[model samples]
Target: MYCETDDELVELVERARKYTEDGKVADYIPALGRAEKCDLSIALYYTDGRCFKAGDVDKLFTLQSVSKVLALALAIMDNGEEEVFRKVGMEPTGDPFNSIAKLESQVPAKPLNPMINAGALVVSNMIEGRSTHDKLGRFLTLIHDLTNNTSIDVDHEVSDSEFETAHLNRALCYYMKQHGLITGDVEDLIDLYTRQCAIKVSCLDLARIGMVLANKGRDPETNRMIIPEGIATLVKTFMVTCGMYNASGEFAIRVGIPAKSGVSGGIIGLVPPSMGIGVYGPALNEKGNSIAGVKLLEMLSQRYELSIF
Candidate 1:
């Protein structure tokens, strides 16, 4: 109900699209580097099953860091909150998401929060599975249920590309392993983490997932409980606190939505009790967020008074 027509959203998208020129795609990940820097799209899904979209909504992108939120939820469900938090702290870091400074400086040497690569690796390690394939299957099952799209799966190209460049992530895993924070083969853990990040989702798929979270883990259309209400709340809290890397506070002030962003230029946003938003803009700011996507969300938030704050 927030946005009455697709044209309204299209106008917003066109306005935000201008900022794409000010950013650049994430070239660090070779596969991700291939994304069109000027492309931007958005989809909004409501509890009533209404959806509004603009731009290339069918364009798929890897989840990248955004997968951390889903992995953390599953990890918490597999292992209790106490067990997961014992290995990873709930604090946000001012340093870059991939920075290793805090890991060395902290006394216990655990990653600050699950949104960062280090913490996400620990959470990925906690996924209950007999093997790497089994673990990824379980994670995919969750995604399938959330989006009602069984075809959703990892982009192996992106997975392999990320795995190839995951040297820093390997270091973080080894460091956490040394601190007794995570157990198991570092390489296997990296494989699972990288695959998890490589999961592909289109804007509509992302919006559907966000809609479930906004509805407190229930699929309004199917009337089924996809995730526990408490778990969804916890995940949303993390999205508010640490979802946008170091720019979370600024995003909160500007957009005021519980959301998660990825280096692949995807963002999943929640307008609690009603709507879920998905945005994709490959052009990234220095902080690894979708620059134009963030701007679009800010405009949508202000125009619709969508801030949960």
Candidate 2:
């Protein structure tokens, strides 16, 4: 069960979906645009193997930017903390996730943080891999191992669609390469990054992955350590500061938790020590967050006092 009052959570999701119309689905990425704007779902997983699900929880969606969190962790494991930080800064940029203006003005041109596209591209380059397939294979394996969902993998349809429309991302990578923030072939790095972004998962699958983060890298189901606890903490801290695109501060204040949201209207969040929450609402706010999903999280956080602060 999600908590003592599982039925209340169901009611919460139903209530939140009323606001779905306030935001629009992200259509620039044609694959994501195909999703029903009114679709909404939520799922929760706890370390003790308990689960709670609500409407449309089984709907599959691409991870989009949420994959940045896992990529950051894998990069740290492969490169260590100091080296990774030296390549990317830890500060948040108030600008949009894909904005190139910051790269032109910032000193040294290091990505402000790994949660954004520039930084994620840097982290993607940092991940251990000889080729695009190899890099994505390693990352995908780690995700499957942690979530124990061997069935999950890249959705090629979504990946192809994103690669086709990733002109803005291409510019970000090229800019970073010129500034020495990113190295190697820009095309190869962009390919791997886009592949990671299109990793497909349902809310339930995301909740399982989030559960491991909540448990500090331990898989609650098998009681196995996935990553070092230190890595997990660092990942969560970034989520708190920069995971919600430009709306992170508002999310941290209202929802009060460590979380990451994606352009596909999916959000993966954790309430430390045990609770993991996954939300999906194709309708997105101007800041690119799931409109109804955020509302549901707010209600749960307020009712359960799930914030770490």
Candidate 3:
């Protein structure tokens, strides 16, 4: 195990918790703004089914942008990779996750990658369903399989808040629609995308989900393949390149793990072939990542030599 005991993990959490004072919760979403900025917690799950936890491991947070990775994986499974990539490119962007500047500049007008809001919206539209309920059900089903938690569902309050304030995202959709990138009703796409972002998961649940990915889409205990190995590899590659909004490069250099962070201060990290990590700290850096969460991962990476690089 990367962390032998809960006490060892707690030490790291306390050290990283100190940095939470320097960051702030994301307030633009309104509902997300109510999060306790000082809150920090972590969980690590190994392939052997051992889990080590620290701080308030019961705390729940929305997936926010981190949902993009899961949605992208499902989209690829529903539609072949060739069809999915035709709608979204694989390149990383220097712009902020929600920025629409690149959409206007790129000749094809497709999103640079599914990690960005633009690309994620396109992926959301691609989820095969006859209606919003069907689409979200399909996504929740994937979440259930990944985490082995059938009770996992969306936080409707957070979903509503995002839908109300998603003007910038709607703008991106319209732009993409103009370029023939995304189809169907714009509002419907936004509804599905916002709910996808609002799906709630505790640190433990996140760790379990990460474990599946780290195990290359298999349930460690059952060894059942929840996702194809190729899709798992593709998603992890995006997590390395574009996961932390625009700070992905720095994170790669520092932590050297495949990770995706959400504005809700949740991060899903992987130590390939063995361990999965989940961290929650509603205090965010300027780039929208969990500041303390990132610090804790950096410390763990250094201490345990956990870098996949």
Clashes of each: 0, 0, 0
- How many residue pairs clash in model 2? 0
Residue lDDT tens for model 2, 255-278: 989999998999999988888888
Measured over all alpha carbons after superposition, the RMSD of each candidate to the real structure, in angstroms, is: 0.8, 1.3, 0.8
lDDT of 1 at 214: 95
Sliding window of 10 residues with minimal summed lDDT for model 3:
1-10
Task: Give per-residue CA lDDT, model 1, range 109-204, as digits (tens).
Answer: 988999988888889999999999999999999999999999999999999999999999998888888999889899999999999999999999
Q: What lDDT tens digits, residue by residue, belong to model 3 across residues 168-216?
A: 9999999899889889999999999999999999998888888999999
Q: Estimate each model's TM-score.
A: 0.99, 0.97, 0.99
Model 3 CA lDDT for position 82: 100
Model 1: lDDT of residue 307: 90
Model 2 gets an lDDT of: 0.89
lDDT scores in order: 0.93, 0.89, 0.94
Q: Is candidate 2 or candidate 3 better by lDDT?
A: 3
TM-score-wise, the better of 1 and 2 is 1
